[model samples]
Target chain A: MLQWRNSLARHATRQSVSVLFTSVGRRVELMRAFREAYETLGLDGKIVGVDIDPLAPALQVVDHPYIVPRLNSPEFIPTLVEICRQEKITLVFPLIDPDIPILAANRTILEETGARVVVISSNAVALTADKWLTNQFFERLGLPTPRSWLPAQCDPDEIDYPVFIKPRRGSAAKSTFRVSDPEELRFFSRYVPDPIIQEYLSGPEITNDVICDLEGEVLSVVSRQRIEVRWGEVAKGVTIYNPDIIDACVQIARALPAVGPITVQCMMKDDVPHFTEINARLGGGLPLGIAAGVDSPKWLLAKAAGIAVDIPPLGSYQRDLYLTRFDESFFLTKDDRAQMASRCL
Target chain B: MLQWRNSLARHATRQSVSVLFTSVGRRVELMRAFREAYETLGLDGKIVGVDIDPLAPALQVVDHPYIVPRLNSPEFIPTLVEICRQEKITLVFPLIDPDIPILAANRTILEETGARVVVISSNAVALTADKWLTNQFFERLGLPTPRSWLPAQCDPDEIDYPVFIKPRRGSAAKSTFRVSDPEELRFFSRYVPDPIIQEYLSGPEITNDVICDLEGEVLSVVSRQRIEVRWGEVAKGVTIYNPDIIDACVQIARALPAVGPITVQCMMKDDVPHFTEINARLGGGLPLGIAAGVDSPKWLLAKAAGIAVDIPPLGSYQRDLYLTRFDESFFLTKDDRAQMASRCL
Candidate 1:
């Protein structure tokens, strides 16, 4: 039965193109979007998904899911290349921000294995990896950005209370804090690794997903006001149609020369967006944007097929639609885990 | 400014009816529903809400909010009654399940203070509180229920694997366990408080919000398939039009002699609903039922005013309208806390 299924999977991929998702942990919605766009276009496509954990829910939904070594492991890239060659993967992409920089650096190596990596330039990835550098880059481009200072640059006596202390390069808000006094600031600076103190910006946070083509031209931008966050990830978001945020996103993408989908995070203060972090990949809540009529997966698929991108002049999308998430568990026995784990090699 | 606000609050309640919400921790949506319904009815109804914590988000939204003593404290009932009389609160209700039985037992004591309590008889609350009794009662009444076994009665050698071990009287799925072996069952039985063994019913969990009049006649029952749960609470729920589940909810409400709004929990296995729980109060997901056109708050409001409820003959409601919940926040100051705390006295 296993051999028959593998033969069927190979037959299906032979008739169409294949896309790969790396470190695709619990990104079932993104995988579904690509599958849907492929089915709509009358193409039988297979998604080659990879995650370190065999229990990753995203792996369950894809055709060829592999359990590879951690991204930092020496064997990781080599194993990924072998899989790409074996699966005939045409387009390789990483959904996570941390994974983007690594993938971008190994773009040439991955391309040599017949699967071209779909990521922004390493230059843009480096700037985004560090929040402090991102603020400077955004400031130079005349974009609204949060005022930031390294921990070493702060003067205790004149420093403002109620400021944010965060890592210089962080994702998912790991080791982040809000300090109200000098004591807290001093404590968190030592507590958090590579602490970067930032001016407190209060109000609603908004995320904008900007799709740019290979030519570095913005195709469309969809912004949503993140109403709630659970465990430092967006839990509830509402699609918003704001011309100013959209314009800012387009300008930022052009300045950074980001290709494919690059999502920018901003917080609204005094009715103006202050760019906080830029992710050179799809946002966690990109499905909400897609549900609101933003066809991101379709654009990415077209690019992977080496087809020219075409985004219509009118980029209108549904607004005020709320996206709320909840947990769903998939049970796998011990034997199933063992089999999937070995399949990565 | 405090004195002026107090004077205005007294004036507002003096002109219209008042509703007291006890243990109103974070029920902002329920409070909003009442506020909107009151506004539409043109009755300047003031919500007098009380919680042990002054930082309760629900308190921040109401006109009269308080920090009361713990429910188990001797001062709780007296303090609640005094506030009801002083605030001229004509209706008193508790949202928390544990608080319901205590309030139900003190129903007449609360009524003596000219504030009618919105709760069923102590008998109904007692049956609903114990899962074992609930199943036996449902089974006796010809309603489908999961076969249950007392922990002491279960033999490890002969008991079925994949049984559920849960607290006989628990809320929010606290200390619930799904054991697939004898060792697992034995271990969980020791860990769980007041453990009761139940036959595992696999399928989708459906929650039905049933609103019955003061006479225990169910006016409407809105059932929904709980698509997902977050932290053991319904987060992503879609309205389900299951005639069997709806009919079962109505019959269960009548059998229990439950009044006002009672929510029923069931598992749909092979097209038949196995009743798991019968709560004699509105559920956490009642807003979904209301959004699906149940109008529970409206029905309860009419009962509070000693007015007869007129549920339409057809009870036709919007079907398949999805209700998604997200976290929202409320900020309060030190002074705001002090004033609301004092108002409870």
Candidate 2:
């Protein structure tokens, strides 16, 4: 046991060498941030991607890549465990929320195979993974949130008109719809078995990604106000920091130590923080967190491995950092428009 | 969706078929009682046996037998899920407590695959599966319980002399030990990382197995007091009903709707019930429960499959139910023993 402890300690002191064991359907932005975190940690290890999708961009820079089925498939976790065991993986991280519970359940078994499973506690993961549950937990903690109820539980006669119905377990504006009254609620409730009826909080939506240890100690915190989302993924965002919201995020984090990497999303209306939901894994604006001196991926990996995390000094980076996807449509030439029109014709 | 629901309803009503999923672990008795409950319900599904040991007696009645690895192993749940899916299993009952959490976690996925996963909610599962957590939850509800602390948090100064130390997550008294002082606690705590230290309550150790519906309504409640345990398995037990302890058991059942087919153990002393631990699955005296008339296994499976549970009326069955297992040593005949002794000589 002493020798094992000594070996672990020695491994921790060396430069950060990281591996990302992932599958298909991962958000591109978060994957990029993992690479940035590797750079931030001043480690020699590069991002290693594993996905069955041959076209996934993650395969481009990955030091090693393995083609595997989608993470939701039955073979995904067992295959990953086998790879981690054979490869002597130091840390196995999961990008998907559904995968979080499954991975956390295998912590001890994976650790026996010499791979540290760094996922949030199942309690924290469940509470944060489901958007409706996230709102309920925050309300219980006396945190501000948009008025929300399950469509089946809500009576339009009892509430204000013009409520919004959103998927109970998704991110961004995926499957979000505005409901005017009882008819719409009835129609949608039958269509969507699980959805939240939330009183629309009119304001720009912003998300704060806070990384904390199991004991609820915040290692680094960063926030980004979302400007646009096109297909359930963030299109653009601007980074900002609010101390009050950050403190609330810390409290929520402390309440859920099993939540390793999380994002507390809230809407700001007239300087009031109205939390909408929480994500148990990396949020869309993770790159912004990385740019703002929050090396979340490295800290998370280190923490899961039971290694001490030395977060880069907070003063080392700026807070106004931001990122945006550069679509070719933004700088289309006349020739491109002519070609597009010709194709349409 | 409408057609699917209609077909499900039709399938449930047209079949009085009974199917049994049995494990050779500690909950074998619980499995038997559940079978009796099905008989009372007029469900036709026959019980099936599953264990790595093919010689398990449950195979005597079950038409289909499956051999699998240990229930606590990581491969157990996934393998069971695969089998259930392929077989179009209506109700996949888990007789073991540790299997409760994993089953509950993947319930949605299992249900989607045409098998109804029956287990309590994750929160309730954790509370009942962990002895220390169950004690704390009961105490908060003002239920009677002996003093207890998690071994990691136990201090010699805090515990009374002659306390009981039990592993937080094991069953059948495999990891239970009687310890008197700090020296013993130190020695035992070294083996198990998170044992629960409890004030030794001297009384008849009684267990009440209750089957409840999703609405927290009791279908049947069978009581048993432990007679003896050898090599960490119940060797002998007899069923008896105590109105005093039964009342407390009812309260506990109502406290968690997620809890179904639960066996709660307590100490009956001075005509008072002192709660000890909760097993979310069937208990060891399940066969006794079946013999006494409240067949739990069948009823639990029926309810899990969304079939109506025909709970037998109270006092409909006799008490004094008994169950016993012979030790392997008892299997040797007199001639075999003599031959063995001669060989030794």
Candidate 3:
């Protein structure tokens, strides 16, 4: 019976190829781009999209869609792997950061069925997942990071007053506040469940999408700084070049030997880049980077399929790219305003 | 805002009480009895049944039901806790053995919402979950237990032939196999996955439902030998009085300062009771024991609620009280038959 099952599986695998794609919230544009890429590649395979929301538009575009419990959860990785097993998935493309960590941890488990896994290692994912910890890592490595600390865990007597508090593991700026007093510190901890007390670095935040090879060699790097944020997301963002930020991105990318298609986020302060965090998957601003001539998805897929990835020429690519979307914005309380102003922005 | 939320929570807690009850598989009798007991006590609280199966009968009887994932699984516990937080669950009742360990570990997290967790500690739960480990624990404490060892891990020169390979974490002869050669061991591992190769004792198996207090002081212990197992579960059984078994149960209860019902299974051979495993929650034969004037659940809850559980005199309790149920008999392959004699009658 076991032999029969094995032979049937082998026959099926030889007949068709399968790819698993995991997403959190809405990622219609990313999924559409993926479909376009696969079609252009002329691969005879199926793309399966997994999301907690059954009604997500990305699901509609995929060949096979499975509604898992939630994507912003630890279960996403295991649940997607289970789906992969049932569907005989050949490749996995993580569309979100949380899935990266889980996929990396259980890569062997997913690959047991002769399906190869394409995920950043758990160590790489862990180093980049927590914004505050990522910044600390950069500082420890002398790679330039904004001064950050937990006000609740910090000594007020020695450090500067008025810091920024943002929820550590979140996309967009939710529950982000500015505080200048012990009273505010108390309130901030009470308000934000997992707040990161950061030394608000001066200047704007820039997001750089970089695709690297298996040996930590950078193939392409494109940057975007948030010019406008509405309802905790980059509602309007423009692609720009900062030499320091680009250098830092290359340095960070070169440090991760097994990671692919990671996004480096930082703030440029006085012509110096202060790293904030790294996302181990495609960033939301991927289209801007792709339009700027990075072709990160193609490069990422090549590495995932076990094909050798050639580092693209480091010549100047298209810049001055921008993306705009409508979002709701609310008032920052009086304390919130002071906290925001203190972040040296 | 925190104070207001706290006040609102307090108000709700005062207004109505709701307890969470998580049960495994399709056991409705236990859940119904719990509901009846709570309603009789004028607690005005509802039993919330959680199971992976959508068709679980417990769901029909509970005031609120969650047909979620497995309780021990990574996804299930967090989802269960999230539901508890959203519903303001006050008390958590772990009716399943596997869920006991997880629930016990997260007791502090559950109790953070001004709720009470009535569970044994994680250490106790872990100590009793695995059969081989439980027996080893008994042997370590100088208590009587069946001589057993995994032939594969055992010293080759010391191992006896015709050894029984039992599922390391399960019973009722389902994955059980007997092997006398390397070929048989290879064949058995294919089916059992990780069977414990043990020197199967020639004796009948018996189960004892021992109810203990918070400090591990025994209130009552009832013994029942297995007459039959339907689909790897206790379906037909006969009550018996074995003082040695009773002493072992008391010693185990005393070793672990558990605060709830515990069921200990043993095999009696040569007038000696061999410890198999200890169950943190009530057993399947508890209803029959209750019929025989045990009232285990009432005694347990009373003790947990700070009431005394004084077991009535054993004057009315009679030994050799046999009970039988008609269920589909399991079909054992030839290998299974060699491992376990068909004791169905």
Candidate 4:
């Protein structure tokens, strides 16, 4: 039965493109966006959502939902490959930070099953994952970044009292602190693992959604100033057409050579975009970008299906578009849990 | 024209209830719930939403959205009183934390405008708002509470490592940290303003929605175990009917004499609910409680309209009802912003 299904999916690839989303945790909007894209483009495809947890919200909305092992587990890659092979997945997108490097590192192996993993290069991931290296990369690219230092290399006396200290390899603002004095700086430096201390950028933050084609050519850049942030995600944001921010994002995309969607974050210092870090996956606030007329999901879907989509020039999207978000729920029952668990790989 | 409209609203009060939600920042779901309740009950009343910011998301959905002064501003209470008188608002609900005490303190003044402020007594708000005082209150009520100490009262050597430190008066999990050692605790105690130190309850958290009538009668209690939390709000949760938790919540309501909806949060340690602080307003995750069949919005609206609502007895909500949430956006343009600003008081 599995062989027959796989053959059927293979035959359907000419008119359709099946996509897979890894670590599809709470990304129900992204799943819905892709579904809408498929409908709009008149393409037939299956969206397979995989996560370690069966109760993942995004998994409930996809065409196919499968439970996979944790990212660190040895069987994870193999399970993904089998799913791709079975579902005839033409494109794969990693939705979270940790999944990106893992998928990028195993890109060749994943693509051997005829699935194009949508990720940046492993080198780019390495440069972006570590906060210290990201600062260095920003300096190397002539992009202004917040002045950062290693704990041992910096003198407390010389450093500003209200500096920022965070883990060198952390996401979602975890274990981050705003050190007010020398005492806090010393305490948090030891508290956080592999800490990177940086001068606090006390300015409005800008998050840019930089979309690129499969060949790493920049397609569109949509910059949104974060009005409010919750749990490291933009809760309230407004899109702005700032030339400098757009240019900085375009420059970063060109330098890093990102594929698909990458989110570039920066803090404005004296009206200049001081680039912070690049997330190699689609951002949480990508919905706002799409709403502002970039239509990245549609563009990506069109590209994956080998259709010629009208590509707008960079920075051509809408400006002053505001976004305010609220949580919507999916109600599940015990019976649904049982059915979901039965589909585990 | 205003007097005529007020008279019309007064006439409509027999079959409808005009609610005023103060500081309606991001309670879009709550707004929608009240709207749904109005529709379900076949009522005809306007929902007036007030906020200091014109860009608040919840303001977009209400029948009448008015931008009010900041809570700390001198004009805030008078403006609200004027709005309540002009709009003929029958019931007033405060959405955010800071709005609660202000509304409670001015309840009589607001009620003189013929609006019933849905808030607890000022004493209850005072006890709930201060974490240190809440700990003492819990102990007095014979409830299990985490060992907490004021900054000047506690010894660092006597405290356990990995204890929690936070502002005595804080919300949204702001400025809270887990102190791993003596030095960090000492540093953070001074760092956080008016800090309280408590034993960190290393267990799953459960947020209970305890609904009460205007007479301070316990209507129903719905307890949900928080499977995941983001920005101090439940991202994923499952409704559970733990009788102990329900009893504890009932005990709390009885002791504190709560009015309307109050949220009781606790952490389970060794299978016992160690009560944490209380929020005198509706919980952020009240949607889950409504979905679980408590239907607090409908109940509140019906009660305000003098319509008979069939609220189930305590501990009668659905068990194992799961909720998983994602953000949905409201895309607004510059014109919308101008119009919203024009509605300011």
Cα RMSD for candidates in order = 16.4, 26.8, 24.3, 5.0
Tens digit per residue, CA lDDT, model 4, B1-345: 999997786566656579999988888889999999998877779999998778888999999999988899999999999999899998998887889999999999999999899899999899999998999999999999999989888889887788999999999888888888888888888889999998999979999999987878899999999999888888889999889888889889988889888899999999999999899888899988888888888888888777777887788888898888888788889889889989966
Interface RMSD of each: 13.0, 35.4, 31.1, 1.2
Candidate 1 vs candidate 2, TM-score winner: 1
Candidate 2 off by > 4 Å: A1-12, A24-46, A214-216, A298-317, A327-345, B1-345
The CA lDDT at A31 in model 2 is 58
lDDT (tens digit, per residue) of candidate 1 on B31-118? 8888887765556568889988765667777888877889899999998888888888877777888889899989887888888787
Cα displacement (angstroms), candidate 1, residue B255, comes to 1.5
Per-residue C-alpha lDDT of model 2 across residues B13-62, encoded as one tens digit per residue: 65544343636432333444555666555555555556554334343335
Model 2 chain B: worst 10 consecutive residues (lDDT sum): B325-334
Lowest summed lDDT window (length 10), candidate 3 chain B: B325-334
What tens-digit string does per-residue lDDT give for candidate 3 at A193-224? 68778776766888888776545667878887
TM-score for all predictions?
A: 0.54, 0.43, 0.43, 0.95
lDDT of 3 at B119: 72
lDDT of 3 at B31: 64
Residues A180-287, model 1: lDDT tens digits: 777667666876789889889895999888877666678778887887775456766777878888888888888888877788999988998999988888778888
Q: Quote the positional error of residue A264 for candidate 3 in Å.
A: 0.9
Which should have the higher TM-score, number 1 or number 4?
A: 4
Relative to the unseen true structure, what is the Cα RMSD of model 1?
16.4
Candidate ordering by TM-score (highest first): 4, 1, 2, 3
Q: Which residue pairs clash in candidate 4?
A: none
